[model samples]
Target: MRRLLSAVAMLILLTSACGEDTLAAGTYDGPLAAEGRQGAAHRVVECDDAPTGGNNYPGEYDNGALSDEPEAALRTAFDEAQITGVHDGYVLVREDDDRALFTFTDAGRVRQALIVHDGEAFGKEGWYVESWARCDYAELPAAVAERAGVEIWFDADGPVSTRRVHSADGPEHCGWQHLTFLSLGETTYVRDADTEYAEWTDAPYDSEADLPPHAVDTGFHRDGDHLWRSPDGTRAYVGNREKVAVWPRTKDGFTCA
Candidate 1:
């Protein structure tokens, strides 16, 4: 599944060029305003199942609410994530080339001046959006928009700019029956065959022969949905296993870190 996801992501990245007259293969489908996308209301979208939102669109997205306090909240989240090196009186966190999160607070009130964001595509929009606008239902005020420093979003067409909306009822909302798969690229990795790990072993063995002079079978097992085989070819692992890998572009790429 990871390989498949990577393949799809690669295809999307390769096709998502900012050129003209292209059919657009990638779909960072955020809450389409035309379809009444209100995917910015945080703390309200009850993610009971935590499905991937990008499945609906090529790319997934989210937002944060900044009142008079943003810097403090950012510091908290950053510190909690164990990310240091916040010197310029601001904290910028980004994973992979596509995902970014940042916060620039006032002199000290980080929480009150916070502007939260999540799952944003790169190149199209850079970091930091502030707003003084408030939500009536959530008890936010208008000044929030004016105070906001950045806006991140995806659009099919029209005025291209990211804006925050009520995500509790937005298109990016993740739920059951909603398998948002990014049609990235066609996969080439091989799966396991019943007969043997043909991809790893030399085929053409007519008989299930036994050990040949110190040859011992180690067997196969699972390592988190991935299958593994020892270097000596004497033993093998199967079931839930993941091979060491990276995304080349996305953060946690290949999960090496």
Candidate 2:
């Protein structure tokens, strides 16, 4: 299933560029807008189970809730899982390119897991997003939960930049699906696959009425920088900042601090 999703995402990224001519010549200098979208709200229509409001889009995405508070929800899940032990450090599990989860555990047993996100893909219209999901150890895809158990610690304090690479027609095409976060003092920047391509504009495409009927206008939080890997490790995300450029993760672009 992972391979299939990756293949499909690559296909989308490759085919998405073919429709670029639909946009007017030159670059779209205007603020990203969902001008022609069909629905009054801004969100991912493909997520049919999502709630009614832009902020509530996650009504039930992939078994997640729009109203779920990351930290609080994780606590509930911990209780249900009957997890017990002293608090341990956090584990950053890369599910895919665009989504990831920060699982806080105790003695290698996952007690709580929160979704780490970039405010770009799954938030408000033209805004950045940082949301979380709470899942029991069993709820997590076996691979991710297992990886968490193995204890892979990501070096978050490394130089804030790294190289991201991709082929014109490969999983890297939808690179926006996988993201890593970096901090430069007060400001934060997220690096991912989408950064490398100009295939899609950061426009809030709420409806198919937009240039591409398939475009869904997502929202995000702007208070800080966010970087998330989609649960599948096939996509990437960063908070929506106007005109943010994507850089390729090639060579030794970044290292552990």
Candidate 3:
């Protein structure tokens, strides 16, 4: 009995250690924010319909041979460009001599597809952001999609739910403002606008107590300088606010319509 208990304890310890290792291995410590010029807009289209080359999707001036390891080469390009917030969870979906396709979940839990083209046909080399969708994995070449599927994991500290409120009209739309609320675990982070926006602020808090209360009500209240939904999260009262934004909860997450 003693030997059996010891073996069971050892197995449990090994399982715990393996779980921690896997989590740590998948953690990404790179810049969580985008830098430099923004890439092409995300769109749903056939892989063959993806843009080839232009100012928006510039090609590198490389006269040498293409790198044998396309995945590593693409990682180098992504790091050099300081692209969007792709923090770990990378799966190589397809690869060949001239092109490689990868899928990764961004910090916002938005699945994105990336393609690295050798540019042999166009005499240049470059990487492109193929597609990004909120819930589903963006469309890909049928074969690649079959292999990649839609499996993705979010970091413990990554955004699990997102809610947004935007100003519909302003002084020539000049004073237009947007607020995004990202819920990550027990904490909620608020941003003034999307990460790509020029001016923005990021604030994180644990609970309503952390925010300065602007007003209080039985069901609705204003905390953290932003209006919040009721405890049930069904209704919100925005006094004198121009627009009321309500996002329905979906099986995957919050859907903003």
What lDDT tens digits, residue by residue, belong to model 2 across residues 194-245? Answer: 4343233222212112122222222222224333323323223433333222
- Candidate 1 on 79-140: residue-level lDDT in tens? 44322212122233222232222322222222111123322344333222221111221121
**TM-score of each model, in listed order:** 0.16, 0.18, 0.30
Model 3, 35-106: lDDT tens digits are 223222232112322222111234432423343344544455445543333323444544444444444433
**Model 3 poorest 10 in a row by lDDT:** 1-10
Q: Using TM-score, give the best candidate's number.
A: 3
Best by lDDT: 3
Worst ten in a row by lDDT for model 1? 247-256
Quick one: how many clashes does candidate 2 have?
50
Query: What lDDT would each prediction earn against the true structure?
Result: 0.23, 0.28, 0.31
Q: Rank the candidates by lDDT, best first.
A: 3, 2, 1
Off by over 4 Å in 1: 1-38, 41-69, 80-257
RMSD (Å) of each candidate, 1 decimal: 22.0, 23.9, 17.1
